[model samples]
Target: MSKEFEIAREFEVDATPEQVWDAVTSGTGGWLWPMEAPEPRVGGKGPFGSEVTAWEPPHRYTNRVEDVEGISEQTLNQLDYTIEPRDEGRRAWVRYVHSGIFVDDWDNQYDAAGRHTDFYLHTLRQYLTRFAGRPVTAFATFEGPEASSAAGAFTAVARALGLADDTAEGARVRAEGPEGKPLDAVVDYRDPYFIGLRTDDALIRFFGRGHWGHPVGVSVHDFAPGADAAADEAAWKGWLNGVFSQP
Candidate 1:
């Protein structure tokens, strides 16, 4: 007989259950979790090659195991989430159950699941809090002839400056530029205000505008292998013009 493993966690979130539910159900929201992709409907496919067995909106959701690799025989695994009202706002409870197994060595899987659950819940909280008490009309703009190139270069600079990460929220491209580059680089635009980095041939700049506000600006400067200051300045200005003039 395979031993069963169960784990439960609770979290108190400032956002309402509805807000949390929307984030959980949306495809873009799935990025907040460990799943490569998560379809938030009953009978829908999810990470771990499982299927959603139950979905009750902001109240409850459940997943059933459908496939497992390296296991002698297929078994059942379950994940469930429930939300309830609390004094200040709402609380969430996540339950995971594993059944049917051979040799019973799932410690690593359990740990990974725990981490993913925490990440998902935290992302939901962030989304809700960010939009809370704020107008729904926040917007941004990239005003330049080479807006696309500028934006792409800006993102590269951001990565170099550590202002953004491959896994951070809003790190995903929201819009693409003319040349298949990411135009609107929407990340968690918060503290540190700006970033700067030096590429092989240029100095890249990235300015952070708060979420729902105007972006400061981005610039690129040229740098020769061992050119004088004046020569470097001229080269930088020329490169800037060339990059900014793309049609």
Candidate 2:
């Protein structure tokens, strides 16, 4: 019989409970860097047809998928979040629990979920630390060959973007990527762990720690009005897929 899986995590952020609450609630799309819930109240609509099941200001929130298009059948999928004041009310303590049923490929699915949870939480921390309250949009894509090493994945993305894998912060950069899209960016942040590029239209980032310690991923935080997010996502996806397929 197919079984179910649950993943839970906790994270501490240098932001207040109210700040974290806004990010979890309606203010996420702006800085949390993904599709956001337009309305975060009970009976309100959210991303991917998710509806708010529980809502408490600056304390707790829960959402569940119901009749959402593009959702895969799994038997169960729910996200519960709890936020509290910590560090003498100077920081936020958060809990995330995601539980769902998987009819097949339980191992890979669970691993990916856990790692992605980590990555997204890291992104949230970065946002709260440096870019909170700034307008932003996010697009992410994953690439495969589960055998690929973290360093190798980082190299591929760096080469594809015409930048050094170990680029230093504050370096002037001009590169062209797949689909002949031109990128005139500055190397803003770089480390053995992550890379960030600042461009005219967006802040781009690539993570070497692909989900589950394999596959590589890139996320673009676009700020332009009327930007075609779907097309941009497709372009990057195709580019990364092609890069990984190369011998």
Candidate 3:
């Protein structure tokens, strides 16, 4: 039998409860790869056809998948979000929980899920603080090869992006992304596991999952209108493969 796994988080953001609601329910396609949403009320259809288990505007939302798609093993997945207003509605506190069953490869699945939660939540905070109400025009995910799991992988990635050694929060970075995508950005968030950059029209996130025995990953959230997501994805894929495949 598969055991239940739950990841919980409590954090505050500069956004109001309603805004947080949009970020959760309406979808954060900007930071997250897929831009999908559920209906405002209970029983609304989700993007992946999951049933909306609970819904309360700007407050609580929960969706459950009876059996996770694409996974051969049986697994029940549910994500719950609870929001509360703070500071006369100027800011808000969010309580998030992602619970599911790991029918196979429990350790690796749990680790990837947990790390994703941390970085995704951090990206949410960045969106709220820096780019609230700015719709995502394009989004892409970049992945390195299995060899990227080797030691010092992120160092090479970061250097290629033109970031300085020991680049801390608030540091300036000027780099060219896939297809010469200009990134005149600032380091908005930085940790051993992840680093986030905010350009005028995008939020770029780098995941140092290689340090945790996984390949490196990157997410690009473009706010510019008419941005080509498919092209960007292809470009980034090629670039990451090159970066990781080199001697």
Where is model 1 more than 4 Å wrong at Cα? 1-3, 30-48, 69-72, 87-104, 131-247
Between candidates 2 and 3, the one scoring higher on lDDT is 3
Q: Least lDDT summed over 10 consecutive residues: which range in candidate 1? A: 134-143
Candidate 3 residue 173 C-alpha distance from true site, Å? 2.1
Query: Candidate 3, which segments miss by more than 4 Å at Cα?
Result: 70-74, 179-182, 211-214
lDDT tens digits, residues 1-247, model 1? 4545565666766667776665555533222322434576788886677788778877777776733554645546676667665654554443333333333446654554454455444434544554433221211112223332333444443443334354344453433222333433444332243433322233333343322133334433333344343443344344333444545
Q: How would you order the candidates by lDDT, starting with the best?
A: 3, 2, 1
Candidate 2 regions off by >4 Å?
Answer: 31-40, 66-74, 137-154, 161-203, 207-217, 223-247
lDDT top scorer = 3
Q: Write the per-residue lDDT of candidate 2 for residues 1-247, one digit (tens) a residue.
A: 3567888999898998887877767554544455665475787775666778888887888878833254455456778899989988799999999876755667977777776676567657666665666666545445444534445577767777787655677888877666867878877666554667766666666766653455665677666666666877787777777777777
User: How close is every model to the real structure, measured as TM-score?
Assistant: 0.42, 0.67, 0.88
> Every model's Cα RMSD, please?
15.7, 5.3, 2.3
Candidates ranked by TM-score, best first? 3, 2, 1
The numbered model that scores best in TM-score is: 3
